[model samples]
Target: MAFLELHDIHKSYFLGKEEFPVLNGIDLDFELGEFVSILGESGGGKSTLMNIIGGLDRNFDGEVDVNGQPLDHKKEKQLDDYRRGTIGYIYQSYNLITHLNIVDNVLVSLNMTDLSKSARKQRAIELLQKVGLGDQLKKHPNQLSGGQKQRVAIARALASDPEIVIADEPTGALDSKNTAEVLELLEGIAADGKLVITVTHSQNVANHGTRIVQLTDGKIGEDTRLKEAYPTNDHQPEFKPKILSAGASYRNAFQHLSYNFWRNSLIMLGTAIGLFAVLLFSGVGNGVNAFIQDQINSMINPNSITVLKNPTGKNLSTTELQQSLSQYSSNPSKLLLSDHQINTLKKVKNVDKVEAGYQFSAFTVSYNGKNNSGQSLQTWTKAYASDTIKTGHAPKNNEIVIDKSQAIALSSQKKYKSLLGKTVKLSFAWVDKNNNPVQVTGNLKIVGFANGGQAGAITATNYSTMRNLLNNANGATQANFASVNVKNADKVKSVSKDIRNTKENNKYVFGAITVGDILDTVNQYVSIASIVLASIAGISLIVSALMIIVSMYMSVSERTKEIGILRALGERKKDIRRLFTAESILIGLFSAVLALVLAYAGSLALNHVLYGIVKFNMVQITWGNVVFTFVMAIVISFLAALLPARRASRLNPIDALSAD
Candidate 1:
């Protein structure tokens, strides 16, 4: 029995109903330690016969047996394994991948073997050294001469240490001097204890092998022996063949990307711009929400709930009720809160304090012969966040706390603190019990300045001082609103809900408001704006995805020959798919990294500009946003590669190898 056998081989091509036969009844036996040349002219079925033996073309009537077991050519996986473990091929074109260096080109085959990383490099270097191109390992194929390129191809063919080596037209492209050198290299390959087959049209090339089989019209016409076979030195396989790993596939993809970094960087930068816009917009949303919340919290206590009389006897909250109650300043009888309601609110659960407060909208402050007036005057309570007092303490006794702006209007900011000890004439409108408007005036010392946050302030005094002034003026003095306070910040929502649920004769008598209500109102608008802006930015991402799709298809067309080399190397359809997908994903990964860098820079520049104006950072990118960018990048890239990678894998290996 022979080491390799081809029995009753027949092959043909069909153009519709016409039959064109290429091989007819080809019977051959090959063994270790022999170099055989199948000599034929162009279109004489020489290359077709080589393809069948190399497991590249299986559409034939034949039985190929390896060590007594017949091959199942119909099963692609079995044929792939046969090629991977039993056969190595050297093409006339010297098909080294263009992007790889000489050492990397050889490692392409070694990557399929069960060798450690260090061991694979060592063996690849050793193989290149053996071929006498050790000094050119870092050079690309284009840098080498014709004979040197053929030598590299021969090194790749022997990388897997297969039982049989096939060299088709090995010296077809070489001149006389280079041909002699290449022919000598083939003869040395044959000197090793392996079956080396060469296909050629030259009678001189055929004579260099041990035997020659002349093919006439796809049939073997003559068999001649020129010399005896070499001594057998076969041994156990040192490296086992395996499917390519995902890590190796990604590394190959990354290498290809690096090789074409300048071309790919344009796509990466285009993609990064989209991702950066999305990330930066998301960060801005986060910062705006934080800034608004901070401003609100700074102006008023976070736990304070502003309670007012349910003027409309309606179940709604914030329904212009505060505005309506303000209209009763001339008719203070209707707006005044009764003592009974205040006592009832004080009895409510978790209610630490229910301070009855006066808020007469119109107020005038006269200090140092200068007058300032606005609607911000109110009776102070715990609802006023004490920290808002930027210059002095919250008003106590017969004292006034005014907005910093108002104090600055009265004096310079540098000397506004001087007003804390100065006396001011505070005048505001009040009403008698008969609903007659009257002016009330009092002298109060300015004790503190409040830093009216987002919601501005003008002046405030204690409820007792305002009541004393109104009583002395023979005016109505009942509290107009109440500030319900909760010590625990977390229970403010429940307490507010309870306040709104407070009823009189089946009607909710109290309208409640809290920091939550204010935030909800503000955040609803902010959220809508954020989504609109982010969505607008996302259009560019769609364009970027289409760009990647176009780029990937272009890559498939350009790397068609490389695809053939990989397929001929026994890579599966799945591996081919993974290769393109991995490369695309790496592109996305690089784009994401670039986008993150850009987003950080954008946020810094924006925050730097905003902080000077608002005293707050207005753009913030979180870890979640960072993770989202990468995840979306990978997912979109994988989705983009599906069609292109599948098209690449489905390309015919024979046709791809022959593509220009």
Candidate 2:
């Protein structure tokens, strides 16, 4: 029985409704250990017949039987397996992948084998050595002479140990010496118990084969056997589906990208700029929030909630109430918190203590006839005990801690530091029981200089002290607000909410505020600002994605024949897609890493310059930001590569192989 058989093969090319028959009914038989040449003139259907035999042009009508099994041309996977396991092709153009070295080009075919990586490498090197290009294994195809490149192609063809070796004009580009060398190698391959077939228009090339078949007008006009077929060993390697490892794919991608390093670097820089802006802004937002919290923490107790009287009923809008609160003519009765309201605040959950305080919208301080008038004042409570004292001590009975600036103004020597232990007189207007305003006065000893006191004078005395002076002067002593201290700082927010939610007569009675609440509002604004800025910066990333798509499509166009070579080596379409996708991912990863470095550097520089003024790091890059940046880069790159990769994978091998 014949080792290979082609029965009644018919092929035609269609131009619209017209049919141009390329191959008529042609029957052929072949055995192992035979060097057969199909010789014909140009346009004699020689290459078309070779394409059919190589399983690349599967649209032909034929029965191709190999070792007693009929080839199913319609099944793409079957055709792929047939080409990968049963035949090896050597093109006249050498068709070597430009980015791969000589040995790597050969290994491309061996990679489809189930052999281990080391074994595949060894086999590829052995094949290259057999072709007499062993020392040039690391050289790229462009570095080689035409003969050397054809030698590499030949080595690649034999790397997988295919049952049939098909050479299409193997010596068409070589000189006489190189032609003889390649012909001798083909004869040697046939002697090793494999069928070697060559298609060529040169009669001298056909004469070197053991048998010659003449093709004329798509038909076999003559068949001649020059020598008897040698005995066949009939041993073939076990067939395995092609599996391109991710590592191999990435290595290929890296090599290809490295060929155009400067171009790819520019793309990475464009992408990195966008990523840097986003990461930097995000870090700045984080730092600003932290700084705000730190300042709030130092200024006020986080566990304390300031409860203000609801100046207007629920019928009033928030804006109207704020306007009324700011006005001095608004009724003081509405702003004053009664003892009953204070008691109700003490009932709030997590409330450890409630302290009543009084606020004077306007006041006057007199010391040695130096008067500072129209100053705001607040009576001290336990919550204000934590205030830092720059001089003297906390206020005692009939004593006040004045602002340093006010102390300086009232000092005869024009030095506030010298007035710490001095005495000052305070006077303010308050409402009496008859709802009429009256003046009140008190002589207070200067104790300490602290914040959160009178706006201009820094005067703060105990609530009892202020209340006593008002009561004696026939003035109302109602508290303006109350401070409710929670058991823990973390419970301040919940406790404050509960107080604000407290209702009486179907109306919210008290408004509650805490340092945490103010900080949260500030942080929310900062976050919104950061997102808007980052989104504007992200426009560059979209532009970068479009750049990637353009770059990848160019790559597909430039490496069209490379794609054809890989497909002929038995690579699946998905593998081709992954190869291009891998290149894009590498570009993204490079950009992301570069962006992170730039962002951190910028943050360090900004922080270093601002450290003296702000006394804190103003940019903080978190691990979350780094991770999110990387993920965004990869996802965007993958999406950008999709169309290009699909186009590359779907390219017709025959047409791609024909590309320049």
Candidate 3:
């Protein structure tokens, strides 16, 4: 039985409903150790017959049998296996992958074998040596002469040890000397107990082979034998072929990326810039929120809930009541908390201590002929964070603690600290028992200064001082607002809920505002602002993804021949898709690393400049942000590569190989 057989082969090309016959009922038999050359003219069925036997052009009328097993052209996987395990092809153009070195080009075929990695490398080097191009292992196809490239192609064809070596015009592009050398190499391959088939139109090339089959029109016109076939050898290397693994695909993708490193770097840089903007903005947002929280938390007591008399007695939220605090300036008597309300608050659950305090709308402080007017003038309570008092102590009886801004205006900025123990004239209005407004004036010592940051400007005196002055002026002594401190930090919200739910004559009696409520409001606004800015920066990310998509498509166009070569080496379509997809993922991962570096640099530089003014680093990139940036980058690139990869995988190997 023939080692490889073709029975009644027929093939045709279709041009819109019209058929052009290429192969007509051609029967052929090939044995091991035979150097058979298919001699034919241009437009003969020689190449088409080779394609059928090689399992590339499967849409043909033929039965190809290799080693008593029929090749199933209808099953894609089985045909791929046949091409992978049974046949090797060498083309006239050399068809070497430009991105790969000579040895790497050969390894592309060896990668499908079940050999150790080091063994494969050793075999590839040995094969290169066998082709007399050992020194050219590091050289690419473009760097080599036509003969040298054909030698490398020969080494690649034999790398997998396929029983049938098909060379289609192996020396068509070479000179006479190179042609003789190539023919000698083919004869040597036939002597190794394998069938070496060369397709050529040159009669001299056919004479170099042991047998010749002439193809005229679409039929075989002559089959002649010049010499007997070389005897088959029992000692042959065992080969177990496997589908291309994921690691090999990724390795090839990386090599391809590195070969065009400079071009790919531009793509990586574009993607990195977009990621940098998003990551930096996200960092800035994180920093700004942190700064706001620090400033607010340092000024006010976080556990204290400010409770006010609900004059309207309606179901109002904490925000509405807080907003209306200044609106009560015209009718301060309406906001005055009564003894009954204070007692009711003290009895509430989780109420650690309820201190009845006065929060007047406005006050004026005069010292050394300079007067500073401010709002939210309240008597001293635990509501103010004591550690924030930069000078002197909290206000005692007959003493006042004013905002640093107000102190600077009352005295010079240089003398504001010195004015801590100095006397200041304070004046404010309170409603009398009959709800008539009464203005009271007094001399109070400045005991302390409060740095309320850019947001808070306040003035305060002792509750006793304000009450006594109001009493002497026949003013209402009832407290307007009280500070409700909770026992545990966790229960602040629940306790605030209870205070708001407190009833008096079927009406809500008090409005409670926790520090969380204030900070939450600030947090909500800051978060929205940050996300909006980050999202704006994300527009560049979208553009970057589109850029990657374009790059991948261009890569498919550029590497069309490489795709064809890989297909001929028995790579499945899925492997082709993974090649592009894996390369894009590498691009994204590298871009993300670059973006992280850029973001760190941006945050550090920005923080350095801003810290000089605000005394705080306002651009903090968290670990979570770093993780999210990488994930976003990879997802973007992966999604962008999908369609391009599918397009590349769907390309026809025959058409792709012919692409210029």
Predicted model with the maximum TM-score:
3
Name the regions of candidate 1 deviating beyond 4 angstroms: 231-234, 309-338, 360-371, 412-415, 421-443, 468-480, 509-511
Candidate 1 structure, TM-score to reference: 0.90
Question: Model 3 scores what on Cα lDDT?
Answer: 0.89
The alpha-carbon RMSD values of the candidates against the true structure, listed in the order shown, are 3.2, 3.6, 2.4
Query: Per-residue lDDT tens digits of candidate 1, residues 419-454?
Result: 878999999888888888888999998898887756
Ranking by lDDT: 3, 1, 2
Q: Encode model 3's per-residue lDDT on 1-660: one tens digit a residue.
A: 799888989899999999999999999899999999999999998888888888888898878888998888899899889888878888999999998999899999999999999999999999999989988888988999999999999999999998889999999999999999999999999999999989999999999889999999989899999999999988667668899999999999999999999999999999999899889988988888888888877878888889988777787787788676658767778888889889999999988998888876678889989988887788888777768788778888999888899989977878778887889998887789888989988899888888887667868888899888889889999998899889988999999999999999999889988888887888788889888988888898898899999999999999999898888889999999999999999999999999999999998999999999999999999999999999999999999999999999999888888888
How many pairs of residues collide in model 2? 2
lDDT of 2: 0.85
TM-score of each: 0.90, 0.89, 0.94
Which clashing pairs does model 2 show?
Answer: 403-457, 403-458
In angstroms, how far off is 200's CA in candidate 3? 1.2
In the range 177-197, model 2's lDDT, one tens digit per residue, is 999999999999998889999
Displacement of residue 473 (Cα, Å) in model 2 is 6.7
TM-score of 2: 0.89
